[model samples]
Target: MATFTEHYDLIKPGTDDYYDVADFNENMDAIDTQLYQAEQDMAGVSEKIGNPGDEGEDTLFGLLNPGNQPEEKADFYRYSKTEIKKQIQNWKPNLSGSTTFYGKITTFRAEKNGTVYVKWTSSDTANGEFYIYHKAPLSILEAPDQSELGSSIPKGLQQEDFCYYHINYVYSSNKGKPTTFEWVFPVIAGIDYTFMWYASSASSLYLNEFSLGYTDTKEA
Candidate 1:
């Protein structure tokens, strides 16, 4: 008689029993089947766990390191240095204009929170007052009277009329020289702004340049 192993049911010939070819072949076939199935399973797993430097949707590496994703698509991934720099560089004002006391006044609506840069030069006889208003002063098209410059609020307009206001006085000594002055102010998005120069005598200021730039991200 021949006994069998408990787990695999492999035949174990007794010392006194006759040799049996069929039992020997059965054990070999069982071993072969188990090994074939193991090889197939390992092959499927290898496809998912790809080698280094591999990239695509199927591999684990691809899922973890997607490159250069746009703002809308970026969710859990940390932003790269290049991506951060691009965002900061792109934040700039879309509108700009320049005018002198004699030129037409320009008004612009800010597209985003930004800074307004007003650069101008005083004329040869430059002596009077200059003002920057967050909103266009619709009440008066021309500059306010010279006497109003000394008042807390310009004579014609009230304080609430212009939420943001700046005043600068030009002295007669600045006359005939290229006196450059710049006023920088943080402006809110979607608001109209304008600047004007009022000299006791006319044509004393020249608005050489007017521009806008983005404010710092942390401040915004």
Candidate 2:
């Protein structure tokens, strides 16, 4: 009370308590400003972490940028002119739930002809139609279940959720025995990409041999 004059300049014009009245508001305003800034920083980090559809997916972080940009889609699956070959010599079907086919490549190209041809021989099961699908990492490796071909209990070469483009193959009903099948299709906006194959017979399909070749296509 006696020396209130000594601290008057330390106070604000609208209130007597200085810090308790008008000046206190300014202090709170400063704190609120800091809080807002912190929120912005946290949001930036969340954006970087990415929100790939389901959280339980197994992913190579940054491989598929989420919510950022549509991955650069190509008119062709893999670059053309490349020859990729995969060979599975001894594959035990329905052994332990998990089976992986393996092989190698001689040369890889960037662009190719309008069509790609895939060829392979297998002691593949035969009773109904089979499938030749591509393979990639899935959101989760589900317990081996039904293969799309609906063969016997088989492990699915289930790929990640993708917009896949594959042609159909209809074999003769009398087509029995482990044989080889080859077909050529035009490589349109989406085809002839990198993927895998399977046989639709309740038995193990031994991949005797396999090869991938493509014809260079001229841009339309």
Clashing pairs in 1: 124-176
lDDT of the structure predicted as candidate 1? 0.49
Tens-place lDDT digits, model 1, residues 118-157: 4455443545465556754565434432212331344444
For model 1, what is the error of residue 134's alpha carbon versus the real structure, in angstroms, after optimal superposition?
A: 2.7
Where does model 2 exceed 4 Å of error?
1-110, 127-176, 188-192, 199-201, 216-220
lDDT of 1 at 59: 71
| Candidate 2 lDDT over residue span 1-220, tens digit each | 2122242233234444333455556656766787899999988887666564523323323433332333332223233444554333443344233232221111222253355555555554433233333333341122122222222323333433431444333243334356666655454433224433433333344555555555432221
lDDT of each: 0.49, 0.40
**TM per model?**
0.38, 0.33
For TM-score, the strongest prediction is 1
